[model samples]
Target: MESRRGQGSLEYLFMIAAALVIVLIVIRVLSGVSSNTPNQQVILYADPENFPTFNTSDNYFVYQTTVTKIGDDLYNVTFKAIAKRDLSHVKIRATLMCNKKPVYVGDQYLTVTDEVENLPKGWYISRYWSPIRRDEFPCEVVLYVWVG
Candidate 1:
């Protein structure tokens, strides 16, 4: 009778221990899951090939290239000549190319009224790369300038 009672008590303890183990596993599985984490995703912008154009006719037909702001993806460049042919008595024309592709081709065949005479002519220009072709040729000429 004593041995039977001990066996019954042992079974009861084993059942309790099994239940406790299951409960612990359930708690661990539940706690391991997280709901507080965020969905981390970021989006960026795209860049165009051409936007700004520079014209410096006073500096020997040299057109300085404007810096572009590069963004995320692929792009097709666009060009519109902000014509500065009104600088001097010299007529000008420029052919713009990017990656060996012609973008903008412009010509100033007609000479505009000289306004450089109005401003005291001592090689007045704002650009650093611009050089004044002083006394080189005051008269007009058809120039095939390449701007890239």
Candidate 2:
């Protein structure tokens, strides 16, 4: 009879150990799924061919503007430009408007590179990558130019 009691106790301990191992396996699998999943996924906003061009002035022209969603509140905006003449000093300003309301603004000084001059030629210009919120999508980007 004592041997039978010992056998039952050993069986109970074995069952408990097996249950613990199963619980650990489940926990590991769940952790791995969460780690592999991203909280925010990146997505393209608009097709390059469909992107709009904003030419506010004759001396400076704004080319295609492409927007990429990088996070829940982040975007990567790349736009092209062209100068009608050689500008010793130039300032390019970009404004993102949603529903006719301005949401974000950015600007950059044109660095004097051998590739860029005040000429009627296309040149890739500034990139604005920052958090601008997901609700502000489908925004219209307008670029203003100041050259001296």
Best by TM-score: 2
The digit string of per-residue lDDT tens for model 1 on 37-143 reads: 21211111111222233333333333333323323322222221223433333222322222322212222312112122222233322211111122211211222
Candidate no. 1 TM-score:
0.21
Q: Give the count of colliding residue pairs in each prediction.
A: 0, 2
Give residue 142's lDDT in candidate 1 (0 to 100).
25
Model 2 segments beyond 4 Å from truth?
1-59, 72-74, 99-124
Clashes in candidate 2: how many? 2
TM-score of 2: 0.38
- Tens digit of lDDT per residue, candidate 2, span 24-133? 99999998776534332212232223442333334344355566666655565555555444554455555545532224433332112222334434544655444455
List per-prediction Cα lDDT, in the order shown. 0.30, 0.48
- The ten-residue window of minimal lDDT in model 2 covers 107-116
